[model samples]
Target: MPSPTMVASFRMLSSQRPFLRHIRHTPHWPGKWPTVSHARQLTTGSRELEGDSPQPERPKRRQKLRKIRTLDPTKLSPRDYVDFSMLRQPNVELVAQSSDLNDASNALLGRLSATINARGIRDGKFPPNTAGFLYYHTPPYSPPLAGEVRFRITPSPDTASLSEGNDLLTEYGIPWKIPLLHMTDKKGYTGLQTLLLRDGLVTPQLLDIATSISKSVKTLSRIVGGA
Candidate 1:
């Protein structure tokens, strides 16, 4: 019973109501969209995580190596120090003196004098037959002397006389002398005698003689020098 215009208007209104209902059920519909509570919670959780995280610091570089320190020789103590003036010489005579003497004289002279004083022979002591004497000159050349020279004088007779004295000679007689003959007797014979007896081959007797000579030399050295 409705009029034609009214019927048309009612049809249009019905279509618009269905469309609005569809829009209201959709998630992104502006008029009836869902609340953003879950999204906001996720955003807040991300922000809190970012705030709790710590940033890593960078590592530092290593320093260069330093040079090693060295000890100075001048600051070090001397190995040997001796007083030559305090030393005593028995048969040695001081003939000449060095003008260019240095502080090292004590070390040099003390050592040399000690070596000589310990090896010197007392009065009335005969020189060993196996003993040999070596004389050295100022030029410092050792000239060979007879083993029987009966003195083991150092610095040479002429040179020693010019530089020092016969005191060394008097203290320790010639290197080679009749006194060493007794040592040979104790060992039963000389090296030459043992060699000749053995037909040029070294024999036990020769070895024994050598050993005895070595012992004798050691004894003499010990007696002459406290060392």
Candidate 2:
């Protein structure tokens, strides 16, 4: 029913399909074929699909310790009595009881402190002693001292120095330098002396000294007591 010229044009266009197929199948085709990919893959990932911005490598925090030192709750050794009786007559009592000389010294100091405190003195660390202060003297021993193999027995800064304010005075001040006429005092003696009142009551001699001081007040008053 169509004119011959129009019919011929339609046939010509239809025949080009095989020629186009041949061009696409050629190895030298300039177009790159799409790479086969797993169904899980997409050309572009959605924002949500990316792992949360590599959790911005959280600024490393210094490891915190729950407790600076984990002390053995078990009693290391029973208290031993140290005699100061030999130093004086009428030995009334053992001056102190402690596991070691350090503890004994501490006990003696505690007694001394009580006596002084009773007389209304609020002086701080009357005698400062830090050499054997339980913290700095924990050297490892051949036979484990008194417990199972322990870890971090010594105190940690996080636990020991939590109160930042305490060190402010120490940091800014002369910083715990011992005053002296050189080599006059042992570190142990100097340190333990602070706890002198921990065990014993004030001696009678101290009371006598106090009485003398009170009586002498009148003489001093006459010198400075202007008419």
- Score every model by TM-score: 0.16, 0.17
TM-score of 2: 0.17
Expressed as tens digits, the lDDT of each residue in 1-227 for candidate 2 is 99999999999989998998878888756345555562234434444467646666778865321111112222111121111111111111223344467664546433431111101112332222211111111125722111111111212223332222121112234222221111012232222223222322222343345335545665587878875
Worst 10 residues of 1 by lDDT: 67-76
> What TM-score quantifies how close candidate 1 is to the native fold?
0.16
Instruction: Give lDDT for model 1.
Output: 0.35
Candidate 2 lDDT at 166 equals 27
Model 2 deviation from native, Cα RMSD in Å: 21.6
lDDT of 1 by residue, 57-113 (tens): 788864322110111111111211111222322122111122455644323333221
Q: Would you give me the overall lDDT of model 2? A: 0.30
What overall lDDT goes with each candidate model? 0.35, 0.30
CA displacement after TM-score superposition, residue 122 of candidate 2 (Å): 52
